[model samples]
Target: MSPTFTMSAGRPAPLGATFDGDGVNFAVFSEHARRMVVCLFSDDGKDEIARLDLPERDGDVWHGYISGLRPGQKYGLRAHGPYRPDEGHRFNPHKLLIDPYAKRLTGHPVWNDALMGYRADSSRADLTFDTRDSAPFMPRCVVEDPAFSWGEDIAPRTPAKDTIVYEAHVKGLTWTHPGVDAPGTFLGLASDAMLEHYTKLGITAVELLPAQAFLNDRFLVDRGLTNYWGYQTLGFFAPEPRYLDRGRIAEFQQMVARLHTAGIEVLMDVVYNHTGEGNEMGPTLAFRGLDNASYYRLMPDPRYYVNDTGTGNTVNVDHPMVLRMIMDSLRYWVEVMHVDGFRFDLCSTLGRVGEGGFDRGAAFFDAIRQDPVLTQVKLIAEPWDIGPGGYQLGAFPPPFMEWNDRFRDTVRRFWRNDPGTAPGLADRLTGSATQFDHSGRPATASVNLLTAHDGFTLQDVVSYDRKHNEANGEDGMDGHGENFSHNLGVEGPTDDVSILRARAQRKRNMMATLLLSQGTPMILAGDELGNTQKGNNNAYCQDNEISWIDWSQADDAFLDFTRRMIAFRKAHPILRQKLFLHSRERAIDGLEDLFWRRTDGQPMSSSDWEDPALSCLCVELRTASGTPLYGATETAIFAVFNAGEAERITLPEVPEGMRWVWEVDTTRPDALPGACCGATVQMPADAVAVFVTEVQP
Candidate 1:
């Protein structure tokens, strides 16, 4: 016989299963639910021991406390109400639901017809309610003891200007690594071997794709694939169980601690815009079962959901209860999980207010800005969605950095020798001041990235012109068709010496541009070591070797060059300045902060900027009294780009008592240390070179 427990009235202020010294308090919010029942399972979570009705109703919240109930107890909820889809009420007590604020979950949902509230084979479809018990098919929410000895675990708190984000997926990053003892797990990512690699890469933070618990799509499962990118969130508070091999939530905390110990901040890529529940016809998971109208943005017709994220139902962040849940989840990650920051995925949807319009002064933004703990953490926004007015780049409020896609496109077109890209490239290299310079937002507000997880890797950018996403189970029509890539000569990997050499040089040029550019730089993991997805730009479902980082194929020379480039950026504070250069002299020094020039070493004129044929240009960064914009005095550097045919760039005149020394050249196999140049320098086609001035003391 299962152990029975007595209950008492619980407070509804603190939602979810909160464990006190005596027992656990269970609370959930469902304004439209007529009845709510909490089901307790056996220790193994297979047998339902008892069912108790939440007798207390404080406003929209139903809550109750169970004495003698401790941590490790498995439970779920069942709400009975109207199942009218047209009226936007999808409550069905037969379908068990996980707690919206579940700190930990016991199992992954086994896909079955019983898990759905609507009958799959019915002619009426979602209108037909199925009374099958989904308890056996669903995961049980665990009443967890939120206590861990986070000894000396402090946030790294890396400065925004100093942060170099390395985007990585936990499992894909270390699953195939030969050095890691615990592969495909959080412990493996925190292993000494992985930490050493990140340290060597010179990235201050690791922006993990998504760690929140998500559901596996039935389509992918049928095709022998999985959702490799954890964008489909199930439980916002629970860490994905697959990532924890042994220690569960404690293992995730340990990972954070280990990363912090290594001086690297952990920034999670969070998806609060939507849940895994696809559409009205989709599975009745936690949110849809508990309260569909309040949890999801319903259409005026009330039968369909507002699909803002392009993934079925958009989250109704405008609702008070939903907003509270999101805020609570974010705080939980920062305070309990010890994460340093968050990168909001498809963030435009979160800022949408009533009437389904994006608002700059949205309540979500205000809540974060007003929060004491959240305001201190680094906040980044993906800044776009597929909805109306969703392409909101550089429009976020203060302290919220946005991923600048214009920078990526401009850089790609410039290197590809596309006409009229020089001016755009110049703007991007200087932090895209056109987009982010307003509202007193600094240059750091633009997170400049040449490539990210959603697109092609640096290697594939020069190796394949078209996306080969056949492996994704979708025909060639899946990923972005306009990848802004070039195949050099051959389509895929070729042993041709000329093509290989050209591709390597192009990769180096792109990497140099990304690192040397102003604003925060984000390096896609495995890009420095020349990791490729073979032409599979969108490998969201290919969770095998197609997505894993192949350490054996690591390019040591390229990795060294990348490391040196990062070091160079760090050495020169001007490269990563917080302020956007306005071509004005600094207060400390009388020299102009930055200068844009044509290949002839003259300042770019209006006609030059408007010229469609111009492809090559030069940028000069100067120091005032040997001091950069932010840090201590550093050497002034001049960088030149030659995307056209090979040309001789007349080196700009150096300051008095100083000479130009070549520091970096993309044409060479490695960074070259050359003698002082007098006037002119030779640059190969589609290459970039850097020269720093030496002061004669």
Candidate 2:
């Protein structure tokens, strides 16, 4: 490397390598580093041209300014300090590290032993230091121009009551798309074909599986697989390199603009709980090398890290700098990249501080709740981790939606005709009022999901009783065991028409139930087209055909059904409401906001709820009693959920000038509406039916 480049003391206001026309200002935080140098590379990013040490330090931050450097300059950092893994200070100057605020990277790291800070094979693992130069094996951060002409790109701020979230993986969604020109790239997802599909599907928002740059596990690579789901985040500010058609951040910006133009919001799944660098034995890529003790939550011994996320190391959100990094990353996505919101992965770890359990008042949550930029955008939490007391489904504060696992399990168990599920089903249908009703949080606070990437698809939920994850190379012990799913007649795939029909019906029932409930419904990407993983619930390691969406073999009927169902939900205001229905009588029409009934047309009693043989539940719904006059525009609605044998049930009576009209029937997809009910309606076995009030005049 050339030593000709000179450095001057620079201001340490905005961290990261900032190129401001004349040169670049380099600033990084390293509390224990003796010195830090910026290693500049050639245009091709292969040859090291110059190495200059940052000449000043404002508090804990190291800073320097280099003249005559341009926006496209490629560089890496090296911090000089003690390499004591026992005391939690692993500052190795030989291991090239990425800047924590790096907006773009040259490429992915070439996996090698030099990338590690210590000799992992030593008897005292991670205690022995290695002096291997790691610049040739690590990826370099590139100076970003930060200039994009976003001409008239307006964000589609779809209201929470009208949002239908479609969860999809960026590559898996576009890889096998027949109409996509550049498959498996961001541009492909924003292509005309994909946009048309999104608009036609009637989804207001698309919740993307992590688009952030991530690491492919070394062990998974050895077994001929990769980290396809991308939960292991390596760089928070950069987009995934594999998802780009050309090596540029502009491609990601263009994708966001296209989705916004189509009137669809984009929500990213973010992993801030932990990093790709696993444990003490893991590689020294970025954070572990920059400031190990300051960046991570170390254990009492200070040698090991707190593994609350089950991903080897939990981030120290309690630290002010660490919390600032997270907040800055989120704002960058919202302001610079034009993304709508984020769905935090393993969010329980972020809401916790030190040894205290998950708290809504934690620094991380408080920072986001009070931030001007972040409060305007949507924030969703995965709501749980492997840490103690981590299952915080409805415990999050107002304006922060949480992924309701209880909703998922309850819906599955109820549809499978499990005994004693009627009461649970009733609670879920009303947005689980017992859990989310307090703290002034609305019903939309619960992001109700029937299936996500972590578990089975809607088709597999009705076809496989247990998970089939043998292809993941973890021997069948990788995914969750109790799926609460039921295979009607046979396990795995079967051509039996009877079983196939039942499975399709079960899928429709769950899908209908989800749309009819009073929460934000999230549909797994291929559930509409009946995409199947062949019962593989956990396909995080399978990047090939096992995970990609097969467009050619799409279930046109079911897809049409899903589209119609979403449209139906949008058409009915009673289905998706902001307030919980508590059976209080409305002043405008003397009708109860919610009423539970039995087959005899009488209100449900305590004895009826306790009956184990009771498999049917009917509900009467209207606008909340406390709702203002402007919001009480909708009429009454009656729905029946029958899981037992088919029977005739009496429908609830309407007002003087209104009559009950058949609206939706999940048992018959092709069935037409506008059938005025008689004294009784035939409640189909294991099916759902909805009726709305109509004027007789």
Candidate 3:
């Protein structure tokens, strides 16, 4: 009766909602569903266009082909089965839902009570179903043509070791920059001038914050703010419509192409762990309303969802059909969107299994490993979540890089004047081999960061002791308590020269540690320019000037200093290493390439390391063997860190036949200066000195 054609149900080989341009083909793989129907929505979403009952049923797949439809059509699904909460089944057909295979989403969902599958005010949620058509409030899936011509533009293909990543939010990066006319949007980022900024900064890749279609929570919108961070993703495949300058979805793809031509790789921070559809009491925008049981991993009792990500709903990554949907979206980005890599937000959720534990051999992990296209691209993992055993820092398998929290904490503490932090500081400066050694990964496996979008900028890390998130409207309860941060002397801004000097030196010391460390360092946007969120670590809700990068506010001095620091790191080899170091082995001859010494030019004693007042350490590195670590070649360098007040540091004696030359000094008279060699360099207090010692010919 609903204009259905008789076609044999195809094999369940290619899974997910796939459209072939002729008509919409609905296919869902649920080994236990009793019935699955495809629901169509009108343009206004007030009336149901049609409900085509899936007549054909294969082994575990329910699919049917229908004609008289083209790309850009909107539809959803309603799978009905046993409503047994105790058995982990929550099949409700009353709430209209989204097709998991949707290639593109039309717009963001309108938050309302009608979008909820269960009565909002009721005590019992899944027990009593609310017979409401949620189509009016939910976003619709658009049939995409999946065709684009990317003429001559290929991924930058920069290897892991050679690549320098710049982590930035699309809107936040260029939002307040006066040069960018269209501030706080996608077009601003794609502009040629913005690309030039990165090119001049010497960053090879731009890891953008989530650009996927996301939701601004009802509470956030009501408070006159929104989820400015974009971590709470709603649709994996669709770009956020608000980000697009033009209505065409292809504009997002075009941005990637433009970046590629400039030799800059584009990596997306994706959230597959959770969706905007919150809990049983939350709205049913897409997956929840269509087939709650099949799309989500409900608790053994169906009334509740297992909140692993702390975002209300956890996607069933272990589900075969749902698993394929994620993989398909990933491939689409690489093949269709032309993205170079992905940084998985709360990646631990993707590795979860039956007992609600993270399984290394989860279906999602295996799928990515096996996919030829995906395997070739860069895959980075945030590597942890709120769930049990979620802190899988260096536990990820090969071809994966993880954020090193230990490195971040240690570096922060050492530079913050914390007592007895020397030993731990050295380990982190060498790339935290203790965490990543056994994983058979290179030194670059650890993606070191002193600051990211979730925390304070490098400038704030040395100027704020506590989070000032009152602006976020969370009563200052949001963000992490243990930030491992320290304000030099004053809690916030200060006119005291002593406090200001301490903050500047702390910044220099931390930057030196990050750049000199043997790993891939990801510099947060605006960090080099001394950007601050006014101590607001969790500015996820502040979409105003607080979150935007004020390019105009950046001084010439800060810009020059940042450029020199980046250039100095790129010019050295001892900083980046492919293999972890062996403490016993001499790097060249009888003398070790790396020598641990005190500020007195003597071998460091255990007691010296234990001293809380010990304010300085020397790291001497020799790369004379011309050994190559990734793309960086050989060079000898020495770094000295003084975290104390203005005091002349007794310079360590240069090795025989080698003269120490100052490559960079944090307290230089000018922001950018030439290297000075073979002199008693007046080391400024609370400053970092990088001296290059080359072999005399």
Q: What is the lDDT of residue 233 in candidate 2?
A: 87
Against the unseen true structure, what C-alpha lDDT does each candidate score? 0.88, 0.89, 0.77
Candidate 3 — which residues are off by over 4 angstroms? 1-17, 41-47, 356-359, 495-498, 586-591, 624-634, 645-658, 669-676, 679-682, 695-697
- Candidate 2's TM-score: 0.97
**Residue 679 in model 1: lDDT:** 90
lDDT of 2 by residue, 125-235 (tens): 688888999999888899997778999999999988888999999989888988998889889988999999999999989898989888898899889999999989888
Candidate 1 stretches with Cα past 4 Å from truth are 1-3, 584-591, 624-635, 669-671
lDDT for position 99 in model 1: 94
Off by over 4 Å in 2: 585-591, 625-634
613-684: candidate 3 lDDT, tens digit per residue: 877767766663534333442246667777665544344565566565677777772645445464445566
Task: Kindly report which residue pairs in candidate 2 clash with one another.
Answer: none
Estimate the TM-score of every prediction. Answer: 0.97, 0.97, 0.92
- Please say which candidate is ahead in TM-score: 1 or 3: 1
C-alpha RMSD (angstroms) for model 1: 1.7
Alpha carbon lDDT of residue 207, candidate 3?
A: 93
How close to the true structure is residue 254 of candidate 2, measured as C-alpha lDDT?
93
lDDT at 370 for candidate 2? 87
